[model samples]
Target: MTNISRSNYDPEVEESEYDRLERRWTEQLSELRVTQAGTQIMMGFLLTLSFQPSFETISLFERNLYLSLVITATLATVLAIAPVSFHRILFGHPGAKARVVSITQVLLRLTLILVALVLSGTVALIFNMVLGTTAGIIGGICAVVTITTIWIALPMTVLRKLR
Candidate 1:
């Protein structure tokens, strides 16, 4: 057996630029799969809510909030799946994978933002219907803060530490 020098040896395998881009694309697609599932479920829930008999009893503000959430959820669903369309369109072209991956990253961020909004708004709407307006607003704020902390702040902190 040949002995490998520890200082000269890279434990991590080096990937070519093309291979790196492909790996990034694959990872992005995996993330999209998770995001898409949740977005589609939320979209379906929002779509069916309007068909429910109790939906008619909602206050005007609640109705408006529900409508906004439905729109936001729909947007999130679209954004979550948009990367696939982009990849398909850009397929087989030289250097297109990089572009596809970049676009996917942007779309993923936007999708997450819209999903966060839908979640917070849904919570607020439910609280308003069950409790009161103040409670609803508070619930929405709390949801926003929690999501921001977990999704954005934590990532930023980790990145800073790495740097």
Candidate 2:
């Protein structure tokens, strides 16, 4: 997002569309690999929380919130890693590059949305257990709004301006 990073924007680089797609796919896949690792770790931790000794004392609302967070986190992990499976299943087949890259792009976008939700839910669940429901709602709303603005809206605004 800075000028130092923007120095690589070689608008003059000549390449076929297929080649561009291949490059983009590689770059996107690498980015998603980092995301997938983090999401998997979160999912694993969430899955095991119910077994903790102190977990049995939680209120029903807190227990339900934790379950919902685990489910949402699981979905985020699935969405984050789905494109990898998609690529392997179709790799190098005729016309697969374009199709894989296009689908992966959409999946990546959806994965980010899921990640934002997972983060918001985590914040809400934790705050609800620790501070109370009102604080939980406020924390969740703040997290979702901040992530949406920074991750989605800011990029969109910049893209619109460039167009």
Clashing pairs in 2: none
Compared with the true structure, what per-residue lDDT tens digits does model 1 show for residues 91-112? 9999899899999989999999
The top-ranked prediction according to lDDT is: 1
Q: What is the model-wide C-alpha lDDT for candidate 1? A: 0.91
Error of 1 at 163 (Å): 1.2
**CA RMSD of each candidate after superposition:** 3.4, 3.9
The digit string of per-residue lDDT tens for model 2 on 1-163 reads 3364564565336668877887898888897998899789889888787888979988998888888878888887888888889889998799988888888888877877778888888888788777999999999999999998999899999989877
Model 2 steric clash total: 0
Candidate 2, residue 117: Cα displacement in angstroms equals 0.9
Could you give me the TM-score of model 1 versus the true structure?
Answer: 0.90
| Deviation from native of the Cα of residue 29 in model 2, angstroms | 1.0
Clashes by residue pair, model 1:
none
